[model samples]
Target: MKPELLAALNAERAARRACVVVTRLADGSQRLVREDELVREPMARDTLAAPLAEALRTGRSAAIEHEGEKLFLNVHAPPVKLVATGAVHISQAMQPMARELGLDMVVIDPRGAFATPERFPSVTLLAEWPDEALARMPLDRYTAFVALTHDPKIDDPALHAALRSACFYVGALGSRKTHAKRRERLAASGFAEADIDRIRAPIGLNIGAVSPAEIALSILGEIVAALRAERVAAKAALVP
Candidate 1:
């Protein structure tokens, strides 16, 4: 890679932005493709849109034939992050699972008693208001946000942030009736019905989860499903 290209790639990596390095297999010529550039550059979109989208979404590098030219797409995507609003038992149970799944876990809660380092020794705990914590660390497309506090003051603000951003998965832990009430509140706050619908209320896979650990497993399972399903959607969109 040229010095300029390497610098650009490093900048993207530092900013946690998704990008791809397209290298021509024949001549060793290479060019950098920022995630936004794919949409703005018509020529890049026409030639490499589908594959580039797949590579970026899946965070996988691949070699492909495009219009008789063999090219390599090296995808650079930030690791997926899970940001939950509560540092409760369920969040504690999710720590190891999140680690094994290679997701960076962050818990934000204003209640210091629940957000103690003693409870979440291995996880990142932010004992600040959800809105304040999220302001410092913005949610992005690769992020999964969950409102586990069951407190509107804490969870609702986080939900607003997540729904406003491009979080891949947004869920809230509650009953159907609880979620219905929450939905009404969000609508009253001016969120669109489509935006409110993005939240998976009664969160987690329907696996009859009874324990905190079980619930954590179900939630992570659902998050993984959403993550991969999005890649599948990206691929499906390219089908002729």
Candidate 2:
């Protein structure tokens, strides 16, 4: 490989992006492709084209070649964001749990006393209401939104926003009665029952949690369960 190409490949690796290198074999009819640790030798360029295109389309790594040359492609995807829409005590424990799970966490709250860097040292603390704060934060398929405020003024707006977006998880901390009230309010706010149903309310597993830390643990556990279920569903859908 040329120095410039090697440097670019190193840069992409350093950035933790997926990359694929395609090389043409000395025999003009064949090609060699490498992605991560997997390698395919003597593959015709035409034969590899469809899979390569599909991989690139899915933001994955692939390789293709023609003649006696090589090329590398790196797939770079932005890090997923985990937005916790409350700076309450549970959030204090939750943020670190999310970080431990390798998530990029952002804590949002309107109260300065609650949302502080001192409390959430590694989290991106936003001292703004959910509606205002989330307007600046990007919500996508990879994002998880959790409402820990248990306050309509805070949790409602964020929940509403998350429901409208493609956020992977949307959970609100509350009891069964509180969740019923929330459903009513959401229905009144023009959200359909199906949409309101997407929220994991009474938010967390049925672990009978009574303390802040315990509640946080339950919520994170439920989140992991939901994510795993989604992956399973997706995988099942992809099966022949």
Candidate 3:
């Protein structure tokens, strides 16, 4: 890799941006493709869009033989961030599990009593309001948002921010009736129906969970499902 290419790649990684490096296998030539630039550069984008996007989405490299020209795509994506709002009992169960999955976990709550370092020992606890903290956290496509507070004052604002951003997953803990009411509130607040639909309310997979631990397990399972499901579906779509 050239010094300039490495520098460009490092810059993208620092900015938490997604990119692909295309290599001509025959000659070992290389060029970088930033995700944002794909749309503006039509010829290259049109030829490489499908594989480039797949590489970006899955963070996996791919090789293709197109028009007798063999090419390789090397994908680079930032680490995943899991933001759990509300330092409730479920977080105690979920935090470690999230860490075990290698996700950068941040527990957010304005209630100092709950968001204490003791409550989340060895975890990154942010004792700040959801909106302000999330603004600084800088939610992106690699982030997942979970609202466990069940309090509109806390969870709603977080959802608003996550939904507006490119966060890959958004889940909220609530019953069907509670989510219906929440939906009304969101609609009243100018959120379109589609935006409201983005929330996976009644969060966690349907596993008949009772204890906080069980609920946490279910939620993590659902989050994993959400993360990997799109890649599988997209790959299937490309098949004949």
Pick by TM-score: which candidate is best? 1
lDDT of each: 0.92, 0.74, 0.88
In model 2, the runs with Cα more than 4 Å from the true position are: 1-77, 230-240
Superposed by TM-score, candidate 1 places the C-alpha of residue 160 at a distance from the truth, in angstroms, of: 1.1
Evaluated at residue 141, the lDDT of candidate 2 is 68
Give the alpha carbon lDDT tens digit for every residue of 116-137 in model 3.
8877985689999999998887
TM-score of each: 0.87, 0.69, 0.85
Tell me how far the alpha carbon of residue 231 in candidate 1 is from the true structure, in angstroms, after superposition.
Answer: 6.3
**lDDT by residue (tens digit), candidate 2, 78-163:** 35567888888998887777888877888889989888788889999999888887787657766788998878998899998999
Error of 1 at 116 (Å): 1.8
Q: Report lDDT (Cα) of residue 209, candidate 3.
A: 98
lDDT of 1 by residue, 166-212 (tens): 99999999999999999999999999999999999899999999999
Which ranges in model 1 have alpha carbons more than 4 Å from their true place?
A: 1-7, 41-46, 49-54, 57-60, 230-240
Backbone clashes, each candidate = 0, 0, 0
lDDT of model 2 at residue 207? 93
